[model samples]
Target: MSRIGKRPVELPSGVSASMSGQTIEVKGPKGTQTFTATDDVTIAIDDSSVTVSPRGKSKRARQQWGMTRTIVANLVHGVQNTFKKELEIQGVGYRAQVQGNVLKLNLGLSHDVEFPIPEGITITAAKPTELTVEGHDLQQVGQVASNIRDWRRPEPYKGKGIRYKGEYIFQKEGKKK
Candidate 1:
């Protein structure tokens, strides 16, 4: 029995959810999001709460039960509020700036890297070294932050690159003399 799956997801005030076959759609102040559950699980919404139940006593059904419930919960939360990811540039010349619909990154590379911001996601640079990614979809926000960080992952030796805020780099010893 999955503890988390047993708990129904409650819909906060101003948030609404509807189901169509296997798909569930949640609408709130931020935006609308939908999720389709697999046949291994069943989804039901009642009295401003959503629940997921396994179709049978099978491993796959149990696995899907928990996953589907979490997905529905994420949809509810995402529509009600936005998700954000923060990245920090650690190199001396590394920096980030948002110009129009593009994010310009200077990570000591040969040329400045230009990342085109997607329609639903927003990227902001509060400081040259600090960047924030915001969006209604949690996956999109995290993916955008990861894509930007991939340009210059922090090195083990110098730890110079782009990294998530509060991330710790395991530094290695320098070359022996």
Candidate 2:
């Protein structure tokens, strides 16, 4: 039995959810999101709560049961609030700036890197070295942050590059003279 799957997802005030076949759509003040569960799980909505259960006593059904329940819960929360990820640029010349729909990054590379912001995602650079990625979809927000970090991951020697805020880099000693 899956402990997480057994718990029903409760809808907060001003949020509404509807089901069409295997798809569940949730609408809230922030935005509207939909999810379609596989046949291995059954989805039901009742009294401002959503529940998911396995279709049969099979391994795949049991595996999807918990996953489907969590997906529904994420959809509900996503529509009600936005997700955010913060990034920090380290090193002497490393920095970032947002201009219109483009995020300009300077990571000591040969030239500045320009990343085009996608729809539904907002990238803000309050300071030259600080960046915040916000969006209604949790996955998109996280993915954008990761992609930006991949451009110049933090190195252990000088810890120079773009990295998630509060991330730790194991320092390595330099060679002796």
Candidate 3:
């Protein structure tokens, strides 16, 4: 038995959750989000709360139980409160701009890089060096942010490149003269 799977998810006020077959929908003040769960998993919603359970006791079922519950819970939380990830651009002339459904980045390369923002995700430019990513899907948002950061990963030599805000890059000292 999975402890996490047995725990009930508390639904916030003004948030409506519905389970239909293998899918779950959460409607909240911010917006509505849906999640596709595995067939083996079952979701139940009571007054002001939701619970998840799996039919079988197999290894796969155990994994699905926890994973599906987490996904559904994230959807509910996302609709209630937006999730955000911040990124910082380091190096000279490195910056980012939002251009109507696209993110234009200038990371010291001669040519600018254009990143297309996927649906249900929003990107905002905080400062000239800071970029913010907001979305409901935790996996997708993290993947997109990682892809963008991979373009110009911070180097250990000078820690120059794009990195997540508040992330530390350990610098290696130069060789002794």
Q: Candidate 3 has which clashing residue pairs, if any?
A: none
Better of 1 and 2 by TM-score: 1
TM-score of 2: 0.95
lDDT tens digits, residues 100-151, model 1? 9999999898999999999999999999999999998888899989999999
Error of 3 at 122 (Å): 2.0
Q: How should the candidates be ordered by lDDT, best one leading?
A: 2, 1, 3
Name model 1 segments beyond 4 Å from true: none
Flag the better candidate by TM-score, 1 or 3: 1
Q: Give the CA lDDT, 0 to 100, for residue 156 in model 1.
A: 99
Error of 1 at 157 (Å): 0.4
State every prediction's TM-score relative to the real structure. Answer: 0.97, 0.95, 0.90
What is the lDDT of every predicted structure here?
Answer: 0.92, 0.93, 0.88
The superposed Cα distance between candidate 3 and the true structure at residue 134, in angstroms, equals 1.5
lDDT by residue (4-90, candidate 3, tens digit) is 888888998899998777778899988888887877888888989989999888898899998888887888888877788899999
